[model samples]
Target chain A: MSAVAKTLDVKGLNCPLPIVKTAQAIKELAAGDLLEILATDPGAVPDFNAWTKSTGNELVEQSEEAGVYRFVVKKKG
Target chain B: MDDSQGTLSLVLFSGTDDKLSSASILTAGAAALGRKVNLFLQYWALENFQKDRIAKDHGVSKDAEPEGASLMRLMREQGSTQHWADTFRQAKEIGDVHLYACALSMEMFGITKDDLDPLIDGVWGVASFMLEADGPVVFI
Candidate 1:
């Protein structure tokens, strides 16, 4: 697995904030770097998938545990 | 990411907090996906963007009723909900989001560019707004 370049904690935020914050965080990363995001919003599951897809990034991994959703997304090269 | 998704234009006529919040979320989401967002504020919506009043309470839409109002209040107290203006500011910071005040509404409300909050890019006429609105506009 590729190393995570940054970890973004977006817990307690709802709706578009997680996606918005993720987009902002990803912008600071070099192309091909991985961003690990931890979010409490249930909507993050689908939001992350769509966000990565539309932005041309890759969803490297995604999982949920005890209501928290985690996503590792690789920036498009 | 490329701005290949095109522009999403919003015509905001309502100044209610709930409606504005919803609009801000839509703007932020579109912005996150590399879309250019253009917001044209008119009528009551323009009034809420005044420099001195932007942070003040604009209340909920009448349809929200007392119950919906309390629910929103509860969410706000929990810090789960952010002010719509702040969200718009963040959207602008992170992406291509432009906010414009309707010139006709500005004339009706006796508001000038100086009276508006700094978040507004500028005052625009209806024709100017339509020119940038390449896609179907969402009215709120």
Candidate 2:
């Protein structure tokens, strides 16, 4: 069964803000929880990937729709 | 390959309000992730190494700014203005981070050891800081 998910819309935010806010939000979730992020910054992909790698978090799904970048991040550690 | 041995050294040259704040945030974030991080401050960034002068220059505790650029404003805009001194201090304590002052810059600025903050690990030339930067080194 899939785990519960939470969403955070950080549109218009730039580098470090998106990552830092995502980190703060993810920390509040339990293991296996999903974080759905909506960001408009072009730097989110690389930044989030690095954040997940370093933090042991899992990037479950990522895609863009209508100029808004969306990512589903699974909380690991 | 095992990823445990990699180290990231950053040579932060620009002391501009925007760049230095961002650099500090990046270093702190990497240190938080258990990475071996070294930050070599040169040129204007070296001003941040001084004790009484650092706070006065950066206006960290004073809630002031230098001329047109506000150090606090820039970092706050990026959501990285908080607990900077503490972040550096924590990184130093955990052994994941090393803060160094560039000897050449120090000499050019007529600054000596006594003028620098005690948190600084050591002063080194370009070659010394370059040795540990095998993985990735960013010049800001």
Q: Pick the candidate with the highest lDDT.
A: 1
Off by over 4 Å in 1: none
- In terms of lDDT, the poorest run of 10 residues in model 2 chain B is B59-68
lDDT of 1 by residue, A21-44 (tens): 998899899999999999999998
- Docking class of predicted structure 1: high
How does each model score on TM-score?
Answer: 0.97, 0.57
- CA deviation > 4 Å runs, candidate 2: A1-6, A53-56, B1-5, B21-34, B49-98, B102-138
Write candidate 2's Cα lDDT for A1-77 as tens digits. Answer: 37547899888766555666676677678988888999998888888888777777788888998889998889884
| Model 1 global lDDT (CA atoms, 0 to 1) | 0.92
CAPRI rating of model 2? incorrect
Against the reference, the lDDT scores of all candidates come to 0.92, 0.72
RMSD of each: 1.0, 6.4
Which DockQ values do the candidates obtain, in the order shown? Answer: 0.84, 0.12
- Which structure among the candidates has the greatest TM-score? 1
Instruction: Judge candidate 1 at residue B23 and give its lDDT.
Output: 97
